[model samples]
Target: MTVDLVVRGARVLTSQFMVEGAGVAVQDGKIVALAKDPHLPEASQVVDADGKILMPGAIDAHAHIYDPDYTHREDWRSGSEAAAAGGVTLLIDMPLVLTVMPELARQKIEVGERESLVDFSLHAGMMTSEEHLRRMPELAEMGILSFKAFTTKPFLASYDYIEELLIRASELGGRIVVHSEDDQVIERGVHRVRDVEGRKDPLAHHDSRPPEAEVVAVARIIESVARVGGYYHVAHLNTARGAELVAHAKARGLRVTSETCVHYLVFTKDDVKRWGPYLKMTPPLRTKEDVRGLWEALLTGGVDMIATDHAPGTREEKEIGWDNIWEAWGGIPGVETLLPVSMSEGLRRWGIPPTVLCAALCANPAKAFGMYPRKGELAPGSDADLVVYDQNLEVEIKADRLHYKVGWTPYEGIVVRGWPVLVTVRGEVVAQDGEPVGRPGHGEFVRMGRWR
Candidate 1:
């Protein structure tokens, strides 16, 4: 039968099997059939993928678009463009340091919709006001997937407000994603570092915001969410101890889940030495033992999701000035490199399988963020979001080649073994051969719960 697009001559990774030399027929932006040797209709637009591996497009579960340093770092247009280039077809942007609260969340989402080259969602943030909580029901009804809460010092929402919102979200059946870092521990740690390191050393940053801070706050968050009977997700878990705490909670079946970023799993404190500023991020990277333990937990099914904590800051902000690590903005731009980096480091080096990659980068994240089949699956009737990858590929990452407005990646000079050669969103090729070809606004604001 004639179709809109037919991707022929590829190995399709499907739910059942990896079909060798498979051809996928697409009609109206949905996968219609997958066959060993599908007969291509005369009228259909056929694109030969040769022997590349066609897998479901990645869904980046966590990111920050429209951050404070938009022009200097990245805006929706550039970030989504980078996502396209990286084989990510769907991205959930966390509400950042934007001025407006929940009211402007929709406006910001609309702004992203106008510029996004791929499907996206906005994970809303919590503000310490009754005014914000009142909008929770409407936001959930509008299909905003989840709300983000900060429990630590720098970005704090009162425990009272957080609890109230958790209760409200429980009623709405929405998940609350928390940045779990204890306020007191972080405050004391920061102060202690200043006394010794004098705040001039960029290394003081990680020393201040230690893993113990994350563990304490994560435990509290789990307990609080359990008390409220609300589903909660721990974001950017940095240590194995933190993951163990989460595992213990899950063992009790408390509806608690957690995620760890690529940096935390691969890099550690010793690696943080020379790259001081570049190594900066909230819940900073931990020790070698921590990294090994976290990987073990991930393989053991103790971790729920993996997100690129892709926060970009300026080179000026990253430099070791008088303020240094204690005052430098904490973040690293990572959206563009998440897939290839994770695949190279996690799957290849650490023995994580393709199935785990599928779950963490595509299926599980889609389910967590309410995008599901429409965004993450390669099955019939799902959106034809796909990535054609050459596993034997090798590339040295250069900052100039990065697509984000940030124009650089913390992962510069790294050699990756696998990378995406082609990216298609809804049967339309958005990125090819390491560059984006898709136009802005081609992406739509994917309302959550629309495709369960």
Candidate 2:
């Protein structure tokens, strides 16, 4: 049968291994075949990827696009444009700037369907109220994949509230993703450090949210989930102790999983000192030893996925913490650098396997959130979302060249070895040469099926 597009002569990464001299054929926006046979079906467009790497487009499971509100920092259009430029075909948006109740989730879905340049999904946010908990099943029926909860300030849920939420979600066959940081620990730590002589320094931010806060909260969540019996995911896990807790929970078959962002895997507290508030993030960067332990976790399957946690804020918003560490926004723009940085550091620098990269950035996330086979596989019948990466291509990252509305990157001036030269979402080329060619409103909202 004739096909619409053909990608040939590349090191194609499948769920199992990378196959050389292989070809992937697409027809009607779905992958039809992957083979090395010379008698492959004819196609209208053939891409020669002789010296490149072909894999399923990355799926960023955690990002904040802040649509409908907080557009000054980022909108769905700009966020998806940055995702396309970074080789991310799909991103699961967190609900922070926009309310993620049933009505608001529908509104954000409408915005994404009308303005995003790449595929997207929304997570329902959980608040510490009986009214909010009562709406969990309704929101789940409305097609949200998981509920997001926070254990720290401004959004903290009490232990009893979290336990009830987990039980409710378990009853409805839904999953919960948690921002794991103990509010009590952080509050006490902040009080202890707030009057210190160096409290205004960036390092003080790290001290205020110590690694113990993460470990304590993660352990608490694991205990709650074990008793409640539901699928649980720890979002943006930063500390090695936290990773160890997740691994221990998994060993007991608690249906738990965790993710670590690119920044935590690549940067340390030293970067926070050098870049100041620009590098500041919640559950702040940890020590080099912590970084090493996280890398080891990724290699040994202790980490389930690698996401961007792509939250962006204007320079002015970040500068608020210059005089006092507690006043700055706590996120970094990363939707546009996830794949490049991961490849350079995870593969070239640390010797992580290519298959492992595919699993962490693509397959595992899809399976965790019930979007697998359709989004994470390169086999026949999967959606034809793919990325062509040129490993030898080195480019220095700069904010001016990025697509974030915030218009800056924490990774500026750092040269990364591999880069995504072309990205396609469902058989259509959405980005090329670090610029988005896809149109706004071309993106569609994705719904998740029941996941175990």
Top TM-score model: 2
* TM-score per candidate, chains pooled: 0.94, 0.97
- TM accuracy, model 1: 0.94
Off by over 4 Å in 2: 37-39, 196-198
Q: Which digits, one per residue and each the tens of the lDDT, describe model 2 over residues 1-44?
A: 77999999888986579988887999988999998837557899
Candidate 2 local distance difference test against the native: 0.86
Across 1-452, the per-residue lDDT of candidate 1 in tens digits comes to: 57888777887764335777787778888888777755545336877878877788888888887633365678878888899998889888886676335557667667777888988887777555677677777787777858888886545886666778778777777888888888889888888888765666767777888778888888877778678777788888888888888888888878777778878877887777768777788878789988888777766656766778788887787774335566677888888888888778876778876667667777777777667777788877889998887778999988888797766677889899878888888888899987999888888788776221
Off by over 4 Å in 1: 14-17, 38-43, 67-69, 99-102, 320-323, 450-452
| Alpha-carbon lDDT of model 1 | 0.78
Provide the clashing-pair count of each candidate structure.
0, 0
